[model samples]
Target: MKNNNSNIKLFIDGFKKFQKKHDNILEDTAYTQQPKAMMITCCDSRIDPSLITDTKPGELFVIRNVANLVPPFEGDLRHHGTSAAIEYGVLYLGVTDIIVLGHSNCGGIASLFSNQNKIKSSDFINNWIDIARDAKDRTLDRCKHNSQAEQINCCEKESLLISLQNLQTFPWIKDKIDKKEIYIHAWYLDLASGTIEAYNSDLKEFIPL
Candidate 1:
């Protein structure tokens, strides 16, 4: 309380308002969470799943990371945070839908367009963003005539499709899909325009929703 740090003060002040608004919310969702959908989205500060979807506390189970990329399923034992979350959501939570929420002006997707070796930190980011390598390649090949900005934008959407395909790599997810028990989707948010679009698998394009 003594510290005059604006960021900490902001959180402390904001929590009071949030607490007043959802005083009984904790009591309802404390012991269990039965979210209907699992959303894999970006870690961008501007992207708040609850606020964007206009959902309350236990309505959505959100998993956020760089670019919202989902790596293909692999059996070997390794630290798989995203994959683990997907498994928990699909199996234990019994979420009927898994949605990959991609957004515009994504730093992770933009990094894919640049030369990896040129980046100062030859560490986690490059490795992590590599999950969307295929998406970047597809973007480059398809949007050769477009500007760099356009290519990056194109890859942003392409990356969502790649995530959808990766979701199927999980055997359990595929089984659930086969039985029509669960569905996977790709959604893109244009931050500049404040527009949200859903991927239409039937038409093979993103449509405003």
Candidate 2:
């Protein structure tokens, strides 16, 4: 953390790869952007939606925040970064799907159950992490006998479901869901095993994707 600016060279190197392939993509999407999905995920360095999904530029409209949490819809208009991105991606960009992608060993998720050092005292992160409080509660109640690791894994996935429900709290999102214009999905990535599990609406469980 000494030299925070040191990573710029890595980005510049990545951009070189991007530029080599950008010409063909820019030929069609330079004028308009039509991403396939509005994807919400965690800001963890290990989880990159584009890299995980094997998607190119203009393929997915992604929004990342701590724990990939989504707040309940409110009438008040303030600086809601994640919500604003969701609105723009869904309403403005006309994305056909919304994905709440969660992952294992998420630090934000661990903070929910942490008692060693308070992780939610930060100005914005504390209030932001509050959105997942219910998820932590549910995990504790459901997985009380499980190990800490298992509880966190459950909580991580539970947070995804909660966010998906919160997405429905937005009138436009609900209307679209009702009208069959857009669909919501939950996915869990196990970084250790390199396996992805998706929530099955019918069975009400997570299954390997």
Residue pairs with colliding backbones in model 1 are none
User: Model 2: how far is 19 from its true place, Å?
Assistant: 3.2
Q: What is the lDDT of residue 149 in candidate 2?
A: 86
C-alpha TM-scores of all predictions: 0.93, 0.91
List candidate 1 stretches off by more than 4 Å.
1-6, 115-119
Q: Write model 2 residue lDDT over 91-134, tens digit each, in one string.
A: 99999999899999988888888762357479777778889999
Which candidate's TM-score is highest? 1
Query: TM-score of the candidate numbered 1?
Result: 0.93
* Model 1 residue 160 CA deviation in Å: 0.7
Which whole-number lDDT from 0 to 100 does residue 68 have in model 1?
A: 96
Candidate 1, 118: how far from true, in Å? 8.3
Whose lDDT is greatest here?
1
Clash counts for all predictions: 0, 0
* lDDT tens per residue, model 1, 124-144: 888888899999899989999
